[model samples]
Target: PTPAAPHREQAAWWAVVGWLGLLLQVLLRVIRGAPSSLAKLLRSLGLRHPLLSAAPAVAFVQLPSKAPADDLPPLSPPPGRLTVVLDLDETLVCAYESSSLPATVRTQAVEAGLHCFDMEGISSDKDAKGRQRVNHVTVFERPGLHEFLQKTSEFADLILFTAGLEGLSCRTFILLSIKSPVSN
Candidate 1:
């Protein structure tokens, strides 16, 4: 390599860092409702230091100025309504593979009058013969789950968030009598 290779690489790195710092500063200004000029922004962020003074400009994109709220239409839902986001596993209910769940625990949950249901889900793993397996899951509702849903749905829109399979999540919400506007 040439003697100046390291210096060139270092300068390039600083240029990238400067660009990222400038973008972050702009975003922070927008969030804080502050206005700034490009030169003033760079000076304020210390990007004009001797080490970065010779670095080439990274980007020249122009950011749009913030518009007045009065000039825009209302984007939120009606005042009385709100969004209620709930997670599926461990938040609203607990689920386990029927094969792995102990019989005693199942019996105790049933005896305790905790609402429970069974659903079949596809396994992400291959079976012994290298074929996809169907997993039977037993889901138990957390205490006061029903009442919480009833009260929350009264004045808010409910959204279910889960990393589980789409079909499995939809089926669970269906069984719970709640709408599932689920996304991955």
Candidate 2:
């Protein structure tokens, strides 16, 4: 009777191990090949499976080289006006904080069509003390800016680009429009 009891206990343990092995095998097979729906779900969430990482890298198309200048036909002038891109900061106008403006600049301001005005409600910058500082900006236009813009506009479409903040750029545009007849 004792020998029979030992054999039964060993058999029960083997049965439990067999069932566990079968369950693990089924789980592994499911993971190895995910369902189409699961793959779509992963794609929607911008995720890639490990198997995709093992695939070859994508090939890129090669663009044709540009033709040499000598090989191209003689070019005629465009029927429409040409386009001109102008830089605003130093080319058209120079702006500086009121407190930092030089004495020499102040003397030439009148001749250069300098416009001094206070910009309010613009608290985008901070000072050395970490407090918001909205100081007055003084703009000095180039000596022949109006004449240059006028001449360029007659033969080209003018586009202005500025490195200044939006508020400053808008203010400069307004000032230029108000002062220059060519801006109209």
Candidate 3:
């Protein structure tokens, strides 16, 4: 097994036939809709200039523009100012992790008057003497959440959003005091 193992197995079988001939020339230039040009597909796979001087001699295609929605530009919404976006966890409230909450579901949601609270955040993790942990949550509202944000802020412009963890929805909207003007 020497003689440089048959020239290192014929240079790893021509480096797997030069990466399967550069992935069959990029799958036949993406099934022939062509016009790619990574330096003309590495100079049609003979690949030179040290791999065509690091590619990019035009290959940014875009395409979509049959133009004709009356030359597009009229997605409306601003002749009366209405915004309303809302959705902070389960739509308008329902947190939990106050150390795995459950003191009889926080005393039956505070004797069923609901509208709970207890947010507090700050913890992208870092303790063991680096400080920055304090997490606790709780939240709860969502029974006509403050009369649907005071009747959608007297006609839209509410926002609030959260795909989860914007520091626990900005500490559940500053512990649900919400006088608005939150920002980021």
Q: How high is each candidate's TM-score?
A: 0.52, 0.47, 0.28
Cα lDDT listed for each candidate = 0.77, 0.71, 0.73
lDDT of candidate 3 over 5-51, digit per residue (tens): 99999999999999999997776555344545655776688756533
Which stretches in model 1 have alpha-carbon errors above 4 Å? 1-78, 178-184
Off by over 4 Å in 3: 1-79, 82-97, 100-105, 110-125, 129-136, 161-165, 170-184
Instruction: Report model 2's TM-score to 2 decimal places.
Output: 0.47
Which candidate tops TM-score?
Answer: 1
Query: All predictions: root-mean-square deviation over Cα?
Result: 15.9, 16.4, 17.7
Cα lDDT of candidate 3 equals: 0.73
Residue 105 displacement (Å), model 2: 3.1
Best by lDDT: 1
Candidate 2, position 124, lDDT: 78
Worst 10 residues of 2 by lDDT: 114-123
